[model samples]
Target: MTNEQFIERLQQPNWSVSCKTEQQVDLVLQACRTAGISSDKREEIIKVLRLPIDIGFSKYFDTIEYAHNGAFKFLELENITSWFFDAIKKE
Candidate 1:
């Protein structure tokens, strides 16, 4: 789905599970850990991404993973700002 569509879906939470989606979430989480983003930073990224907070933080990772499934690549401090802007863009 497009970023706009993903943002729209994020407004309403859902609980359906997909194995691939879970894997993607895990991938992102692991990347963050490897990059030393810190737990607080990870949580903040989730918040910045506008993911669901009702679910535990672990589960919150899934929101952005599913929303940007095929889009995320290697993340670094230098590129993260632009990446976040791109991910949250309305159009």
Candidate 2:
């Protein structure tokens, strides 16, 4: 997909992300099940086998993203970033 398309998808509120192998995706699916979230929910399960290291934090901070949208509270850095990585994984 194009960069624009990717950026657009990232803007969506809900997404079901998956990693390679069932073992990789197990945690995410389990969380969804525990939350009682159905497969039809407004979530996207992107199956990317690998991710580039260079595609780092830079892509996440867009001046135009929430610049003049007046949606300040919704686009807080802490909130957006926490979704991208698992907190416990970093530990």
Candidate 3:
């Protein structure tokens, strides 16, 4: 997906679990891993990302907000996008 598409999807309020949403989560996590994000930091990201959607969909918004706010300190937006696209291509 294009970065704009990715961002648009992320901003959507729906956090219902589906094959596509699961794939999106996997892509984000894989991107982080491929970029050599530290395990501890990845775990932290995971914790935020995995928060239950049933609990008001906070986790979905929170994860996107965290990424926008520089949770992955070493990664540039371009790098994150690149990693995400690479992960998608690999799948």
Candidate 4:
């Protein structure tokens, strides 16, 4: 699919939200599943989607662990995205 088409698919609101980072990663994963996106391709796709490339599987797992530990609050996607971007920039 073209980047625009893949992006349209991702914005369809077909998925649920529990953890912000996990849901975003899953959305990209599902979009890439049929297209056979490789690891590098996955990162590129996320960049097109305007998400931080560093917010990959490990970050999703960390989000889940944080939620499980009762250490997270629901945040807007924009907030989470900005926070991820800032966190990566700091590192």
List the pairs of residues colliding in candidate 2: 16-44
- The C-alpha RMSD of each candidate to the native structure, in angstroms, is 14.1, 13.7, 11.4, 13.9
Q: Which ten residues in a row have the lowest lDDT in candidate 1?
A: 70-79
Give candidate 3 misplaced runs (Cα > 4 Å). Answer: 1-20, 44-83
Q: What TM-score does candidate 4 reach?
A: 0.24
- Per-residue C-alpha lDDT of model 4 across residues 2-88, encoded as one tens digit per residue: 555544433432222232464565554544343343256544444455323223222233221112222233331222344333333
RMSD of 4: 13.9
Write the residue-wise lDDT of candidate 2 on 1-91 in tens digits.
Answer: 4434444444444333423344444444434344334242222332232321011111344211212222334433333334433532542
The residue pairs in collision within model 4 are none
Model 1 misses residue 39 by how many Å?
A: 1.0
**Inter-residue clash pairs, candidate 3:** none
**Which of the numbered candidates is closest to the native, going by highest lDDT?**
3
- Model 4: lowest-lDDT 10 consecutive positions: 62-71
Error of 3 at 15 (Å): 22
Estimated TM-score for each candidate: 0.25, 0.30, 0.30, 0.24
